[model samples]
Structure formats: structure tokens, C-alpha cells
Target: MKIAIVGTGQVAAALGKGWAARGHMVTFASREPGTERVQQLLADAGPNASAARVADAVGRSSIIVLAVPFTAVRERLEMAGDVGGKVLIDCTNPIAPGLRPMFDATTPGGATSGVEQIAVWAPRARLVKAFNTTGAENMAAPRYNGQPSTMFICGDDEVAKGATAQLAEELGFEVVDAGGLSAARHLENLALLWIHLARVNGMGRDIAFRLLRR
Candidate 1:
């Protein structure tokens, strides 16, 4: 799969490296594609990975991962150009300065969730809420105690969700289908709890959410 990942941050690097290692053609979309930082990222991602301008990367890939900050969602989407008919995986949480959830305040359309706001920003794109409830370290190596950590994903488009699920699985995650995109409300809130536990409460970044069934 040709995956375009926007942003050069930890989450983007983790997902890009994981997918690249899995033999997927990973293109990191960046504002400074020619910078040394992006060059290092490409080197770290291996031969299957490359860097390009946001529009160029998005134009060439079928799957686009928005790994940028919550405040830069609209700007990044706009930079990607026409993303219609593409699977857009949203890996961001609407977090305020104090690590507080601020969906309504952050989103322009009064969206209840960050994914919903992303859908509003790029309405034509097939949006899936995923990779938001865990740290980037978990994304890089999801296994804990020899078991894969759960990755919760939700989207209105089943096909898009399936594609996103496959990517999550490729990263060693146990995917859980969390219903329609509206369910992102709970998922985003779940992200808050994760941040609280991992950062605020000093539970450490190694912790991850899991689901057990008999």
C-alpha cells in the first residue's frame, strides 16, 4: 500500500517506519521535505520510505495518515489538496494546553470529536478515527507481555475502516472495530484517559489499552 503520512513528529515517524518495514511504500509529507530532519526520518524508515511535499505525497497515495497536531489539522488537510476517495486515518487528539480535551473549542464546526471535525475539514475523504488512544512508542512497538495492544478504530465507511484496521494490524495491534465515526467521541475521550494515566499520573508511556474476551 502507498501510505502518505503528514507531519514529521513522533507518531508520523513511528507509523511510517512500521509500515515501511512491512514493505509498504511510505511517503512522509512534510513542509520541509528537503531538511536534514526529514532526511534522517527517511533513513530511519528504510528503503521503502521517502519524503515529499504534502500535495505530491497525498496525490500519489491511496492511504493518507494525518499524524499532525490537533491545531494543524485543517491547515495540513488544505495542504494535501483534493483527498476525495482516499482513506484518511486521523491520529490526533484535540488536546488543550493542560492536556484537557477540547473538541468543541478546537474544531470549527462545533464537532463533538476530533475525527468529526476532520471529516468536516475534508468531507469528501473517507475519514477513520484511529491510532489516537495510545502513545507513539506503542505505535512503534505495540506488543506488551507477548500480547498485541488493542487499536480502536471507527469510521462510517466500512472499507476505509478495514484498510485502516489492516494497517493497525501490520503494526502489531489487535484491532477493535468501534462502530461508526460518531463513536469517535468515546475514543477521543479514551485518549484523554490514556494521556492522564501515562503523563499526568506517571504511569509511564509503556502502558497501553487492551480488551480481553473469553
Candidate 2:
């Protein structure tokens, strides 16, 4: 599968490396593809990976991962033209200044989640919310104590969610279908909880959530 990761952040690096390792062609989209950081990420991602302009990367891939900062979302989407009919994986948190949840404040009436806002921006693309609940460290290795950690995913499109779940499973995670796109509200809160635990509680990035059933 051809994948476009639209960020230089840790989530993009981790997932890009994972997919590239699995033999998928991974291209990281950057405004400055010639920079040392982008070049280093390309090198680290191995032979199957490369870097390209944001629009070019999104144009060439079937799966698009929006891994940019919350503030950069609209700008990145504008650069990624005509994403209709493509599977768009959202791995961002709407974190504002002072490390607060920005979605609630910005979204009118609090009726939609961040991922849903992405859907509004890219009306034709199939958007799925995943890879936001945990840090990139756990994303690189979604296993703890010999058990696969849980990754919560939600989307209105069943096929898109299935593909996202498969990708998460490929990265060694037990995927939990958290229902429709509205569930992203809870998922983002879950991510905020993780950030709080890692930053405030000092539980560190090694911690992850898992589901146990009898």
C-alpha cells in the first residue's frame, strides 16, 4: 500500500517506519522536503520510504495520514488537494497553548470532534480516528508485558475503519472499534488523559491501555 504521512513528528516517524518495514511504500509530506530532518526521517524509514511535497505525497498515495499539529491542520489540508475517495487517517490532537484541549473551545456548540472537523475540511475523504490515544513510543512498539496494547479507532465509514484497524494490528495492537466518528470526542479525551499521565503524573511514555475480556 502507498501511504502518505503529512508530518515530521514522532507519530509520523513511528508509523512510517512500521509500514515501511512491512514493505509498504511510505512517503512523508513536508513543506521543506530538503531539510535535514526530513532527509533523516527518509533515511530512517529505509529504502521503501521517501519525502515529497505535501500535495505530491497525498496525490501519490491511497492512504493519507494527517499527522501534523492541530494548528496546522487546515493549512496541510489545503496543500493536500482533492483527497476524495481516499482513506485519511487522523493522528493529531487538538492541543492548544498551555497544553489544553482546543477542540472544545474552537468547535461551535461542541457538536463535533476534531476528526469530524477534518471531515468537514476534506469533505470527500474517508476519515478515521486512530493513533491519538498513546504516545509515539508506544506506537512504535504497541506491546507491553508480552501483550498487544489496545488502539481505539472510530469512523463513519466501515471500510475505512477496517483498513485503519488492520494497519494498527500490523503495528502489534489490539484494535477496539469505538463506533462512529462521534466517538472521537471520547478518544481525544483518552489522549488527553494519556498526556496528563505521561507529563503530569510521570507515568512516562511506556504506559498504554489494554482491553481484557473473559
Candidate 3:
């Protein structure tokens, strides 16, 4: 699969490297594609990875990963142009200053989850909410004591969710289909909890969430 990751941050870097290692063509979408940072990122991601302008990358890939900061989501999506039938994986958390959850209470009908708002912004894209409830370190290596970490993903489109699940599995996560896109409300809150546990509670970034069943 070809993936266009729309960010140059830690989470983007981790996912890009993981997918590239799995033999997927990975293109990192960046504002500064020619920068040393981006060049180094491509080198770190191995031979299967490259960097390009956001629109160029999005235009060439079937899967587009929105790994930018929550504040930059709309801007990046606008840069991606018309994403009509492409699979769009959202890996961002609406985190405000002091680690507070930034839910929008005035979004037309009612309060909206970050991913739900994203759906409104890029309505044509096949959207899936994922990679938000864990740290970038976990994305890089999603194993804990020989067990794959849990990855909870939700989306209205089953095919999009399936694609997102496959990408998560490629990163060593045990994926749980958490119903439709509305379930992103819970998943985003879950991401806030993960952030609190890792940052505020002093548990550290090495910790990850898991779902065990019989």
C-alpha cells in the first residue's frame, strides 16, 4: 500500500518508518520537503520512503494519514485538495494547553469529537479514527511483554476501517473495531486518558493500553 503521512512529527515519523519497513511506499507530506529534517526522516524510513509537498504526496497515495496537530488539521486537509475516495486515517488528538481535551461544543448540531469534525471538513474522504489512543513510541514498537498493544479504531466505512486496521496490525497492534465514526467520541477521550497517564501521572511514554479477552 502507498501511504501519504501529512506531518513530520514523531507520530508521523514512527508510522512512516514502520510502514516503509513493511515494504509499503511511504511518502511524508511536508511543508518543507527539501529541509534537512525531512531528508533525514526519509533516510531513517529506509529505501521505501520519500518526502514531497503535501498536495503532491496526497495526490500519489491511496491512503492518507493525517498525523498533524489538531490545530493544523483543516489547513492540511485543504492542502490535500479533494480526497474523494481515498482512505483518510486520523491520528490526532484535540489536546489543548495543560493537556486538556479540546472538544468543540458549538459545532452546528451539537458537540463534536475531533474526528467527527474532521469528517465535516473532508466529507468526501473515507475517514477512519485511529492511532490517537497511544504514544508514538508505541506506534514504533507496539509490543509489551510479548503482547501486541491494543489499537482501537472506528469509522463509518468498513473498507476504510479495514485498511486502517491492516496498517495498525503492520505496526504490531491488536486492532479492535470500535463501531462507527461516532464512536470516535470515546476514542478521543481514551486518547486524552492515555496522554494524562503518560505525561501527567508520571507513568511515562513506555506505557501502552491493552484489551485482553477470553
Give the candidate number with the greatest lDDT: 1
lDDT of 3 at 86: 99
**Model with the higher lDDT, candidate 1 or 2:** 1
Which scores greater on TM-score, model 2 or model 3?
3
Where is model 3 poorest over a 10-residue stretch in terms of lDDT?
A: 103-112
Clashing pairs in 3: none
Residues 1-214 of candidate 1 have per-residue lDDT tens digits of 9999999999999999999999999999999999999999999999999999999999999999999988988998888899999999999998877876677544566788888878888999999999999999999999998999999999999999999999999899999999999899899999999999987899999999999999
lDDT score, candidate 1, position 190: 93
| Model 2 clashing-pair count | 0
Q: Estimate each model's TM-score.
A: 0.96, 0.96, 0.96
For every candidate in turn, the CA RMSD to the true structure comes to 1.6, 1.5, 1.3
Query: Model 3 over residues 54-117: C-alpha lDDT tens digits?
Result: 9999999999999998899999998889899999999999877777667756656554788888
74 in model 1: Cα distance from truth in Å?
0.7
* Clash counts for all predictions: 0, 0, 0
